[model samples]
Target: MTHAERAADFLLDEARTDWHDESLWQVRGKRDTIVHAIPEWEALRQLGSDIKDNVLSNLDTYLEQFERQATANGVTVHWAKDAAEHNRIVHSILARHRVNRIVKSKSMLTEECHLNQYLKQQGIEVIDTDLGERIIQLRKEPPSHIVMPAIHLKKEEIGQLFYEQLGTDEGASDPQYLTEAARQHLREKFLAAKAAITGVNFAVAETGGIVVCTNEGNADMGVHLAPVQIHCMGIEKVIPQAEHLGVFTRLLGRSATGQPITIYTSHHHRPKEGGEMHVVIVDNGRTEQLGREEFRNSLKCIRCGACMNTCPIYRRSGGHSYDHTIPGPIGSILSPGIDLKKHGDLAFASTLCGSCSDVCPVKIDIHDQLYKWRQMVSEEGLLPKTKTIPLAGAGTVLSHNGLYNIMGKAARVALSHAPRVLVYNGMNPWGKTRELPEVPKESFKEWYARTHKSKF
Candidate 1:
């Protein structure tokens, strides 16, 4: 197996532990009750999903309209077809400004495109300003959770990481003290950075502005303080108008962290007085995804991450297990489209419990996408050898009543004396951590004939 596959398998193995998986499942349930308090919750979700769908369907026209409007407002707009194109566009902007050091707010697009590494390779220094992202960055690891990237690391682990990296006292483990220490350290970087890059949470097509939601005010601080500000957004992130912002903002934080809303929701219309502003609208396979009717709705994701927080598979396996920048249920569905053969296993990682679909603020039908991706991936010959034949045979048998009855009888008889361990081979992914259900003798149909039919 390849390194990526091993990492994925290891994550899946870890997810099978009951305590680990069930915790996130509870978080999902809690979020549902919170959302249920609002009567228009379902309507808001449909509206949000509809808006995104409309924008994605008319993506080219909206993108062009956004570019024209953004340009008219004195904000430069650049288009990138892929990751390399994205990096070059960003690098060019930074190079033009002679910016070597940058302070960045949380932007998943950057992580997805490996922007930090690319900037480092270009001899530019980048600092992740989000507290969770900062800690993960200092440790040289990818963010483990979407909103709380450092969720996997305990306070003690963070203190240790900080003490080693920031030259703090050896055992300082208090969260407040550590937070202040990081604040002071980042304060210096914030004051010094010539440029700042932020991710666009929502872009308003009507106004030609970008909306960013942040808790720490880092995105505001970075963009407001820096001489030059750059914002990167997926092409599908554009909303029709500013009026729609209220619907998304209401759902975003409540679904994500259970907060009523994030502390700061900043809109950038033009550059800070005399500062330069640029927006890099990225396609990066989003348009291709939009072309698929069955899967296009996945683009409605507001990145609330409630799906991840509530996902049993995500909690058990953790984000790093996905081996992609975006992790959890959303990542599993999204990754296969980017590279089907390499990420094929991710589609099968879920139990199809539909919990993720239930928690999504925008109601992306995440579980449905996961299911569709499985069929599409299998058709593309991405299925691993062992799964292909048996599942296909089962499908064929289940389609015919007589064949299924014969197969059921044979299976029950074969399983009657079979060793428990034999049923759980290495080939069975679920068998690694979960016990197989015991097989009972005689078919339900046969039992019904023996009991209910005679009575009738």
Candidate 2:
């Protein structure tokens, strides 16, 4: 289904829609406050953007460099050209180790590759240790938000989920209680895990180290306990130097959750004694995306989610409507690159508001990329006739001055004198959630001629 159709389904719940919108806005406000406190926030964003651009421009060199350094640090590295290969490589490692169960921290890359489902199919039990991830895993739902995987659900909904799955109290809905319950349940999973998997937040070529930023330290716990550790990262994740990490660290937490820093920024350099560490660097269509000059800048995303929190369209529509691992404005641009035909409608799911670009920590031109995707989709004859036919007629009217003026005057007259029922019915999508403005007596062109003619 198209994003609009799914979004319509989400909007059916009026109270939920309002709550989601307000909740994201509150996070946006928090970001504004925390970011302003940093005197060099914009500078940091620019630096992060620059570093990502440099890395994208020279990904091949950095990826090789990282592999060399990581190998020297006693870390085994595997390269996968696609998701299938990445999943196979990871499964092969588990199959070799004869690992029956694994615990994982939140990793959008794993979500992108659908790794958990793959592992489960191979009969290797997979448990997501992150609280939000665990909640969604038990419910068998994809994450609705990147950082807050269960943000789409309410505490009451969670209480019910826990009641059924975790055996919580009949009506217990307190955050602390639920969290403790999750922690205890996950602790068992962690200790029993034969292997652990994490997503790499950043990989430094200089030191052959990867960073995992988390508030709960779940990644650390899983890695520490599990004898076999796997870290999955996209090729774009590699940076040239360790120093470049500072720029992203300053911008990431603030943009993602409006905090000065993540509670635990754990750097995994190598394995513990008698333990094994594996880094899986997967292309998974990233190389193709980087080849598109107009869209290459999108690789600069730090996954801070500032754009998602600030986007008006995303704030109201909810992330599930996007139907991609990454959602919101950034996903609109990225998804189309992966499959234009299936995701074409996503580009039009925006107001073209630059708020997303303004808030992006790495300064990706998200809205501009959305516009480019829209042009590509339309040029490919991907838009349905319902939109194309009306747009074609509007284009004709807009191109001719006389036709434009006539249509403008007709609209003003109809809006002024026509019955409210005629104006607010099924034909008017804009009227569903908005009021028509007061009609002006004259067209701006007409007023301009009358007033400016004398002056000229």
Candidate 3:
């Protein structure tokens, strides 16, 4: 189904949609409050963007440096060109260790690669140790948000899920109680896990280490406890220097959850005394995006999810409406780059209010990229004829001044006097959910000419 169709289905339950909208808006409000409190928030954002720009510009140099330094630090680095290769490398790592059970912590990279499903197919059991991830894992669904995987669900639903999956109290819906249940449940997985996989928030080329920020400390627990620790990072996660971390670390939490910092911001430079560490640097369409000058800036994303929280379309439509791993403004722009034919509808999902770009810590022009994606989709013949035909006709009329003036007058006259049935017909998609505006007696040009002609 198209993104619009899926979004329309989501809007069927008005109360649920309002709840989703308000929940994200509340997060956005918290972010605004925290960001405003910081005297140098904008400066920090600029610094972060500059750091990423430098990284992308010299990505190959930084990546090789990171690998060399990481290898010197006794960490193994693997490179994957695409999703299938990423999954294979991860599976091979697990297979090499004869690992049957592994625990993972809040890795969106794994979601992108569908690593869990791939390992499961190979008879390996993967447990998501993060609370939100565990909830959705039990429910057999993809995350609805980047930071909060299960944000689409309610406390009661979670209570029930815990009741069924974790055998908690049948009707307990308290956050604290449910959290305790999850902590106890995941603790077992941590203790028994043979290997642990994590997503990288930032990888420092100078330090040859990766940083993971999590409120629950699940990533720390899983990695530190496991005998084998695997860190999966997109190539774009690299930064040129260690000092650049200060800028990104400052912006990440405030932008993501309005906190000064996550509860635990763990850095891994090397493996434990007896443990083995592996880092998979996956390209997975990132290099393709990098080659596109118009959209390369999107690679600057730190996965803070600020854009998702501030996007009105995401809030009202819900993340599942996009039908991709990363949804909302960022996802809309990135998904088309990955597969324009399949995800072209995502580019048209927004109202282009530019709230996402305003909130982006890395300063990615998300709305502008969305507009550019739409044009690219059209040029690639991914757009449906229904839209292309009308747009082409409109373009022709708009290009001719006489036709434009005649159509403007005719439109105003028809809108002013036409019957409701004629104006609100099935052929007019906009009329389905919106009322036609009342036409003024004169067009703006006509009124301007009448009022200012003598002065001219």
lDDT of 1: 0.86
Candidate 3: which pairs clash?
none
Q: What is the C-alpha local distance difference test score of candidate 3?
A: 0.93
Once superposed on the true structure, which residue ranges of model 1 sit more than 4 Å away at CA? 1-30, 392-439, 452-456
C-alpha RMSD in Å of predicted model 2 compared with the true structure: 1.0
lDDT of each: 0.86, 0.93, 0.93
lDDT over C-alpha atoms for residue 32 of model 3: 98
lDDT (10s digit) by residue, model 1, range 1-456: 532454566455543444446656665666777787989898988887788778877877877877878889999999899988999999999999899999999999999899999999999999999999999999899987778788767788888999999988889999899999999999999999999999999988888999999999999999989999999999888988889899899999889877778899999988878899999989899878888788888888888889898876777666777888788899888888888888867888788999888878777888888988888887888776777888889889999999989999888877777776777787677787687677777788888888887588
> What local lDDT does model 3 show for residue 155?
98
- lDDT of residue 208 for candidate 3: 96
- Write candidate 2's Cα lDDT for 35-150 as tens digits: 99989888888888888888988899999999999999999999999999999999999999999999999999999999999999999999998899999999999998898888
- Residue 113 in model 2: lDDT: 96
Residue 247, candidate 2: C-alpha displacement in angstroms? 1.4
TM-scores vs. true structure, each candidate: 0.91, 0.98, 0.96
Q: Report the C-alpha lDDT of model 3 over 107-211, residue by residue, as the tens digit.
A: 889999999999999999999988999999999999999999999899999999999988999999999999999999888889999999999998999989999
Q: Is candidate 1 or candidate 3 better by TM-score?
A: 3
User: In model 1, which residue pairs have backbone atoms overlapping below 3 Å?
Assistant: 15-316
Clash count for candidate 2 is: 0
| Candidates by lDDT, descending order | 2, 3, 1
